[model samples]
Target: MNGQMELVSARTVKGPDPVPDLAAVDRLVISNSGGKDSIAAMDEAVNLADEAGVRDRIVVLHIDLGRTPGGQSVEWPGTADLARRQAAYYGLPFEVRRLGKWPSLFHRIRARGQFPHLMTRFCTSEKRAAAHRFITEQVNALGVSGRPARIVHVMGFRAQESRARARRPALEVDHRASSGRRTVTQWYPVLRWSEAEVWQRIRDRGLPYHWAYDAGMSRLSCSLCVLASVPDLTCAAGLRPELAREYADLEEEMGVPFRRELSMAEVIRRAGDGA
Candidate 1:
């Protein structure tokens, strides 16, 4: 909406990163994660819906992991609220799904005192992935949606965030989530954009987003969530000391180790310095 002002070097799956062209997809759903990448995808998804002459079909999917104890988890300033506002702005149906509040054995242990490592992402599976899968299955089985939906599952994943993410293709099927259902297609429009591009797009669009960044939060996942890096954990510890203590306690209780020395104290020390 910034008068279509060109980004310095905005790149999409297609060269030139044209906005109107992406609108050609039939069923375009912006997978809102309250993160800048997903927010950018929301903008593009709306743009695409308009161009494809299916503006009414546009929707936003906000999946809540449901167990964290933060404003961004199940509270007022949570991820779902951020998503709702964005969806309303786009005039699309915002489908907010909660993965539930009950914890499994592993989550209980991690939340109690055990630290989850790079190899283990139980929270994501129990929460994020579960909600996403259920929705897809429900929609695919609907009676009126002929031939299932040739949906473009627009996500906001940036390659520069990590080594593994760096390897993801700008355009590819989400094989990790796909169940051989050709009707469901995944598209990473913001794959090539840097972290700067992600924030720039959010600011330029004047879209509603989370304010966790103001509290020294980098990515808007769970507060003591395991995907955090050393600096991330450290920052969380400083901002939310109790959560840090809980994470440390959890790790000590579990007996398993984290790759980054498996010690939460290291994270706390590295917090402010961005280590």
Candidate 2:
């Protein structure tokens, strides 16, 4: 853990920001997405919390985006339950918070007549808003004395995911969540971990992960995330044709394609053709 150490051989190494003093935090909230990266992040965070003797402050939080109109899940099936199971494995308290105004993400998209784009990602914004609300509630419930409550919000973003994610520091102050009443810190415990290391960590802990990976998905998030790769979109459409058709229906109604580069119908066709 030397700052000047060049640990090139290690799959997981410390990132730019030094690890925070966990014992000083009032609450440690791990955002669970039921994805492999998230699981890996949770494992690291839990271990650090245990070492700091603040395991009691750790809590897992899951943001439940509602299902499609026809009851099909917007996310991978069983994701929320798996997140709960993960939290249970650590003997940590878990809480689920849903979108307030919108019943489902599909409903929100249809109402707006636009699918979330890479540059304009309302879906992520909404989810973050929900998480923020939940964090705020926790801050309020804890009751502020003379000082701001310290809250560490743990997320699972890996350097290997994308250039944007790669550029992120391991820990930074979350100004959006911070106020006079509370100071929020965004912590990416596994930010420097590799995909292989993530899997190894999960295997070592003997924790169950979302089954979507075994079903051929490399990553897990929304079943048909706008930011997903073509192959992933095709695979998701093939596994969940009914939901794919629903998305196509939305596209047809709005007179817009799912992506400017391609349509949901086209993705469905690719899936059907086994492309």
Candidate 3:
């Protein structure tokens, strides 16, 4: 427990944002990714909806972003399969959407030879927010209560992930809210939960999770996220040979050079070198 931290109740400690009544939300979109945080968020969403008697109005938003920087398994089959499993387990309806094209532009940028330092979070806008936008539009099109509009979109962003997120208000208007658009209310139920508490909730609620985490992949960003540490990259590259090779090929094709100047294979080799 030395480095471990738990998520405390942000709502009880700080008063709730009253723009939208917690119980009056017409729709509660559980932005599920089949990851630990998403799983925990989904469970919390369901519980909250039921407690508020809006259980029948809750649904799952699953997006398949064609091809990740690593591979397409997650997009073609993995994400879909996991979403199905989660939906069936929760006895809820899941709306699955596959984006029109590959994240070609984003991948091209990430593979453009420059490491994505915090300033150019091209991946966030391209991949993460892109998916969020798609789901929000879908919900708005589907309408809240009577006419289409954004209701409450709950996500699984942990404060421990970043300092900025750690400072986010418990319930805030979706920053992505645009002028003339029905504002999307954002909620963070597991915002205060720790990684261990998230998993425990999954166990307690019997929620399903992606195999990548158990396979030693942490924080299920795109398989080729720039945020990966050398050790994590080595772990993934070794565990997935073809994936590593594909990334190697991508590095060459994109004409971008990764850190250490050595190939991913070399990185993996160095990982086991001292061990």
Candidate 4:
């Protein structure tokens, strides 16, 4: 909303990044994780919605991962607060949803006796399902007059991040959530953006982003993610020793490594060594 905004442009499937039809949708639900990419995506979505005259339909949502056994955060400290601040910056309605049956993600993982991995990422699945349920509730509450509610679930997933992410389409109809009363679509507004572009956009907008990035974290997810590289894990362990210990202790109890290559204990050791 500040300083020479280079608003995101619409695209075709054969040409470039796909942009959702903001005006056609009754609701634009932005899934912000307090990461830089999500922040940039939110900015892009807002700009496009404003251009489409549907700025009032925008709503920012954050899925809180909950905390650990020792009362420490499972995710980066202040992640939810940062997300709320970002939403407030745009003057958008914000909502936070947590797991219904479980206290936190860690609790669920513990009950299953396994940590989520690349191939079987139940963590992502659970979060996605939770978001869908919340959106469905909203759709039901909107009470569309004669037509199905049109909603777009916006997320921040850049193609440059991973091969799986790169293979994802920028816009797609979410048939799983769609029904006779509601038509749901998923939109990644910043899918084609590079890492530099994301940072540049954040700087241009003068937006408030997560503090973890300033503390040497390249990405923000759980405080310690199994998919993270060793260096990133080490950095996180260095920053949140107690949280690292909880994960390490969980690994010991389950007799399964946090990651196939190494353990959280090893990451903690490396973090200590570097310190």
In the range 1-275, model 1's lDDT, one tens digit per residue, is: 11112111244444544332333344556778777677887786677556657787667787765543322232214667787888888788887665554543235445545444567655555555655665575556543332333445677877787788778755554445544343445667777787888788788888887777877778876665566666666666677665566555556667654445546656666664566
- What pairs collide in candidate 4? none
* Model 4 CA deviation exceeding 4 Å by range: 1-15
Off by over 4 Å in 1: 1-26, 68-77, 100-115, 137-141, 144-148, 175-182, 257-260, 269-275
Highest-scoring model, lDDT = 2
Candidate 3 overall Cα lDDT vs. reference?
Answer: 0.62
Model 2 clash number:
0
Local distance difference test values of all predictions, in order:
0.60, 0.87, 0.62, 0.85
- Score every model by TM-score: 0.75, 0.94, 0.78, 0.93
List model 4 lDDT by residue over 1-275, tens digit each.
21001122364532576676666778889999999989998998898788889989988999998987789888899999999999999999999999878789999889989899999899998898889888987887788877678888999998988998899988877778888787787888788888998999989989999888888989998889888877789999999999999989999999998988888899999999994
User: Residue-wise lDDT of candidate 3 within 1-275, one digit each (tens)?
Assistant: 11001112233521352223445455667777777888887787777666667777777887665554555443323756787788778788887655444454335454455545567765455555555666556656665443235467778887877888888866676646422344466777777778888889988887777777777777675555556766667666656656556656655666664443555546546645731
Question: Candidate 2 residues 98-177, lDDT tens each?
Answer: 88799989999998889999888999989999999999989988896987888889999998988999898787777887
Q: Per TM-score, what order, best first?
A: 2, 4, 3, 1
